[model samples]
Target: MSIQTGDKIPAVTLKVMGEKGPQDITSEEIFAGKKVVLFAVPGAFTPGCTMTHLPGYIVNADKIKAKGVDTIACISVNDAFVMDAWGKSQNAEELLMLADGNGTFTEALDLVMDGSGFGLGNRSRRYAMIVEDGTVSHLALEPTGAVDVSAAEKILALL
Candidate 1:
């Protein structure tokens, strides 16, 4: 089943680009004691994600953090290298770029989106969630191919 507002974040490992290159981070470490806003896109650097979805977060990141959020992160099914490059390209220094390269974390959350038709294989559906110390308090899942409810503006509004 898909993750719900009351669900705890699943146990899985994700990647992030560090100075030493890709590094592994556990889900527990990310949410265990933090108020986090995590948004997931289908892929990194895709048209919608690049031009629209991520930019909304980039612009509103401080405003969201001011509302008591500890971290704002973006995740995609792409590799850490791609996510890192995209973050650099967008000047997303304020956000954490998480890479669910193998889609393991996405699958653990039951939020997998089939992208075989697009030659993208398994990917994550567009969604955003407010996680507090390991438990999700709010979840906004976007419709297929849409970027409405999961946009940063909406997440900011919720905050």
Candidate 2:
């Protein structure tokens, strides 16, 4: 089953573009003792994600944090290198650009989505959640191709 409210985030190592190179950051390191807004995209630079989803968070990051969020992270089933480039290109310096390159974290959350038809391989489904000290307090899932419920606007209101 997909992750839901009250579920502890799955333990897995994800990558981020560190000062030296791609570095590892575990799920526990991210969610433990922190209130986090974690969102996932089907791919790094897709139309909906780039134009709408990710930008919504980037634009409203500080406002979201003002409501007690400790971190705002965006995850995609792409390599760290690409994630880094995408973050830089989008000016997403305020957000954590997490790279779930192997999709292990997505699989552990049971949120994997097949994108073979679009020339993309396995990917994480579009969703967002509020995680507090390793436990999810709320989850918003997209309906297949929609970005409505999981957009940052909705999440900000919830917070």
Candidate 3:
């Protein structure tokens, strides 16, 4: 079943490119006892992703954090290397770009999108969630092939 309100974050290791280096952070470590805004995208560097999805979050990171969020994260079904480069390209130094390289975390949350049309294989659907202390509090799931629902403004409005 898809994750719903009050569902705990899946216990999976997320690869992150931190200042020190690539580090493996577990869901518990990230979500436990913290309020987080976690957004997922199909892939990094894609058109809609680059122009609208990521930039919205990047520009509104401070506002989101001011709404009692501990951190803002962006996840994609790409490797740590790709996410790292994309973060730099987008000037997303403040957002935590997580590499769900294996899509294990995506599948576990029931959010992976089938990308057979583009031959990209399975990926994550665009969505954003408000997580509080390891459980989902609110979710803004985008419609298939649509981008509006998961925008930062939408998430902020939900908050």
TM-scores of the candidates are 0.98, 0.99, 0.96
Task: Tell me the lDDT of candidate 1.
Answer: 0.95
| Model 1 residue 107 lDDT score | 95
Off by over 4 Å in 3: 19-21
Candidates' C-alpha lDDT: 0.95, 0.96, 0.92
| Candidates, ranked, lDDT | 2, 1, 3
Candidates 1 and 3 compared by lDDT, better number: 1
Q: For model 1, what is the error of residue 142's alpha carbon versus the real structure, in angstroms, after optimal superposition?
A: 0.7
lDDT of 3 by residue, 6-88 (tens): 88898999899877878898998889999999999999999999998999999999999898999899999999989999999
Q: What is the model-wide C-alpha lDDT for candidate 2?
A: 0.96
lDDT of 1 by residue, 1-159 (tens): 899999999999999998899999999988999999999999988999999999999999999999999999999999999999999999999999999999999999999999999999999999999999999999999999999999999999998
Q: Candidate 3: which pairs clash?
A: none
Candidate 2: residue 123 Cα off by (Å): 0.4
Q: RMSD, model 2, all Cα superposed?
A: 0.6
RMSD of 3: 1.1
